[model samples]
Target: MLYFIGLGLGDAKDITVKGLEIVKQCSRVYLEAYTSILTVGKDALEDYYGRELILADRDMVEQEADEILKGADVSDVAFLVVGDPFGATTHSDLVLRAVNAGIQYRVIHNASIMNAVGCCGLQLYNFGETVSIVFWTDTWRPESFYDKIKKNRDLGMHTLCLLDIKVKEQSMENLMRGRKIYEPPRFMTVSQAAEQLLEIVQNRRERGDDLAISEETICVGLARVGAEDQVILAGTLRQLASCDLGGPLHSMIVTGHLHPLEVDMLQIGCPGRNPCIKYSYQDG
Candidate 1:
């Protein structure tokens, strides 16, 4: 049997009881590391689980998945994923492969940022299509996600922006030389995301496109979510651009028409003496 288990957002202890049991029983356990990350390192997880975990990078999971799935039909194998197994489409593909190989698999669910984001008080039902904000380069700045944010704003729904995280990426120079060397991992911070969004907004304005969002648009920046040191700040896009949300794995919420209760809840994270004073229904 093949088990795809989800390790919830924090440390190794966040694994569900059932997931922990499965991990202990599995003959081989592989941890999928590229999609998202846990607050603790592999050593911490190994210590808690009392089992060593094989780190499965992108190449191993995407290119050599059969090796990981081999003999799963006869023996118990566990593939651990940060957040829920279904959060990323790659895991679904793995399941398909398991099925074709006549391997029976079970998925154990856990908390992911998609659902845990509501800790900031935004109603889950009010969220529209989620969009990803990628790292912008000198000549490769893509603003395709802006259209999705605009559509959500048009319908008075909030937009959840999943910031980009580049892990084990090859540098252009290395790729040109046909070298397999990888650059360091990079996790996009909230401030960087805000700066990129503001730049896009400026570009759109210069092009004479009346955008639904602006510099004064309300946004919620969350960092290290589900961790003990997690930080959530609520303010305008302009304010967030200058705000320092220490640590990696940040996410942003572009709010639309806010409810009175949401406004109250979000204000708790706002900086300054009078947080709620700046935000009013008339402002929206």
Candidate 2:
């Protein structure tokens, strides 16, 4: 049997009891590292879960999937994901491959960003489609996520902007040289995403369309959520663009006009940034 276990938002102890039992029962345990990451390191998880984990990079999971599934045919194998197994579509692809291979599989679900974003005091049901923000290169900046965010905003629904994370990625020169050099991992923060969004807004403003999101739009920044030291802040998009959210694994939310309950909940969540400062177009 193949187990897809979710290591929930916080630390190693966050794993469900059933998931932990499966981890110990499995003969081989692999942690899918390229997607979202847990707050603790692999060693920490190994010590806590009492299992030796093999780090599975993107190449291993995407290109050499057969190797991962090989043991499941003979014995129990567990593939652990940072959030829920299905949080990233990549895992779903893995499940598809496993199904095609006729491998018996079970998914153990846990708290993923999809639902954990509710910790920000926003109504989960109020959210519209979630969008992912990718890293922009000088030659390859894409605005595909803009339309989705715009669509959600136009419908008066909250937009959850999942920031991008680049892990175990090779540099262009290394790939060309066949050197196998890996670049430092990067996790996009809420501030960076806001800056890029404002850039797109500026471009649209120049085009005289004026539908772009502005800095004054109410935005919430969440960092290291589900962890003890998690930080949540609410302010204007512009204000949040400048705020230091601290550490990796950040997410942003562009809120629609809030309900009275949402306003109250958000105020309680953001004790320091209360009054939730609004940005102005005039400042821009």
Candidate 1: segments with Cα more than 4 A from true spot: 270-283
For candidate 2, give the lDDT of residue 51.
Answer: 70
Each model's total of backbone clashes: 0, 0
lDDT of 2 by residue, 225-264 (tens): 8887788887778788788878889999988757778877
Q: List the residue pairs that clash in candidate 2.
A: none
Clashing pairs in 1: none
The residue-level lDDT of candidate 2 at 11 comes to 99
lDDT of 2: 0.86
| Error at 20, model 2, angstroms | 0.4
Which run of 10 residues does model 2 get worst, by summed lDDT? 275-284
All candidates' TM-scores? 0.95, 0.94
Give the alpha carbon lDDT tens digit for every residue of 129-205 in model 1: 99999999888999998999999999999999999999999999998999999999899998999999999999999
Alpha-carbon shift of residue 270 in model 2 (angstroms): 5.5
Roughly what TM-score does model 1 have, to 2 decimal places? Answer: 0.95
lDDT of 1: 0.89
